[model samples]
Target chain A: MRVGVVTFPGSLDDVDARRAVTLTGGEAVSLWHASDSLQGVDAVILPGGFSYGDYLRCGAIARFSPVMAEVIKAAHAGLPVLGICNGFQVLCEAHLLPGALIRSDRRTFYCKDQDLRVESTDTVWSNAFTPGQQINIIIKHGEGNYQADAETVKMLEDENRVVFRYINGNPNGSLHDIAGITNERGNVVGLMPHPEHNVDPVTAPTRDGIGFFESLARYLGALASRTQGGTA
Target chain B: MAKIIVDVMPKPEILDPQGKAITGSLARLGYSGLSVRQGKRFEIEVDGEITPERLEQATQAADSLLANTTIENYVVRVDQ
Candidate 1:
């Protein structure tokens, strides 16, 4: 499997995301923010960072990048896209996912190994974990507070589209403690935490993030089966 | 030439941490019975005579990029 990791001009975590992709048995392909091509990778990732220096609002400028046009198009065609941290903000700005991330309620950045519960396993990004499983991932951001309309929240809850929720404590005052969510198609997933930062035991706080990368293989396999008319 | 201004403010329902911090500072400095909400202002210069079409375009820009309608509200008007 090949995973494309897109690097925006101000992205700081693209290298780590590429490494995590390779470490999880997938070939890592470096995708550029201006190239306007996906390079035919099976899946794509938008790594965390202060894209475009958080100008205007986080991920607002980056959404207009040339590469994002292709990403947005492919995402609609069922391309598996995983957006982490500021990447999540980009997805929201791009309208690929609902909700917007606002400044932290604490008026300062919060960085820690945060606990999150896997609320759903139907998405391609969370299928490796059981329902309601708890895992620790690195959460570092100044604008991780998630906000959405009440009706949107109700619909997400009713549809089981919420993939992850903050546990132990609400770090950024996110509504309903939502830390992550997936599109209705289950191919696009966005989260405020940085799973790429904790994929290695030697240089990270926990290895719990490997599951997110590993799940890609399982999802692809299931898709292959479905194409072959084997009940997936 | 004319100036088109776009003012953006956090939605009333959304928390404005920056604005709240500014309020705290005002209180610390002995300001009483006053509240403040921080927002952004953009000034766009138009070279030609301001017309109805240009005003509509400015409003569209405010809606499309100058403001995020999800958590913010924006107003577009002529500055000069």
Candidate 2:
């Protein structure tokens, strides 16, 4: 599988995201924010960072980047896309996912090892994990609180779209303890935690994040086989 | 040139952490009975006369790019 990790200006974790992809046996393709092309990669990952300096809003300006035009289009066409941290903010700003991320309830930046419960493994990005499984991942952000209207929250719950929920304690005070979510089609996913940061055993406290990349590779391989079978 | 000013504010039902922090800070500083709701303001310059249609256009633009309607409500008015 070839995964393209986009590096917007001020992007800090694109390299780690690429390394995670490579570690999971996928080709990591470097992509730029100014380019409109996706480079024909099978999947795309928008890594964490202060894109456009997190100006105005966390992802308000970066959503208009040329690459997002293609990302949005391809995402709607059933392409698998994952947005981590600042990338998750970008996805929300782009309206690919519902709701918004406001300042953390504490109004301070938080960096710690977060415990997350896999609320749903129905999406392509989370299939490797079973529902209700607890995973430890790192989270770092000041404006990571997730919120949505009550109606939308109900809808997401009814549809089983809420992907991950914070366990033990709510770090940022996200509504319903939501840490990650997927679109209705399950092709696009966005999470506030840094899964890529946990892929390496030497640096990460646990190799728990390897599940995300492994899940993506399995999903892409299954998708490719389905396409080939359809043609055959 | 005409300027269209847009203000985007968080929905009343939504929690504004930044505003809450400010309110707390003010209370600590001996301020009382005051509340704050932080918002954003944008000034846009248009190339033509500011007509009702232009104002409406700016309003529409505000809905798409200037704000996230999911959690915010925006008001557009011509800059006097």
Best by TM-score: 1
lDDT of 1 at B65: 86
Model 1 lDDT tens row, A1-232: 9899999989999999999998889999999998988999999999999889999999999999999999999999999999999999999999999999998899779989999999999999989999999999999999999999999889899999999999999999899999999999999999999889888889877898998987889999888878888654
Task: Report every candidate's CA lDDT.
Answer: 0.93, 0.93
DockQ of each model vs. true complex: 0.87, 0.76
Clashing pairs in 1: none
Query: Which residue segments of model 1 deviate by more than 4 Å?
Result: A228-232
* Candidate 1 CAPRI grade: high
- Span of ten consecutive residues with least summed lDDT in model 2 chain A: A212-221
After superposition, which runs of candidate 2 have C-alpha atoms over 4 Å from their true positions?
none
Question: What does candidate 2's lDDT look like per residue over A39-62, in tens digits?
Answer: 999999999999999887889888
Q: For model 1, state the Cα shift of residue A110 in Å.
A: 1.0
Cα shift from native, residue A202, model 2 (Å): 1.5
Question: Chain A of candidate 2 scores what in TM-score?
Answer: 0.99
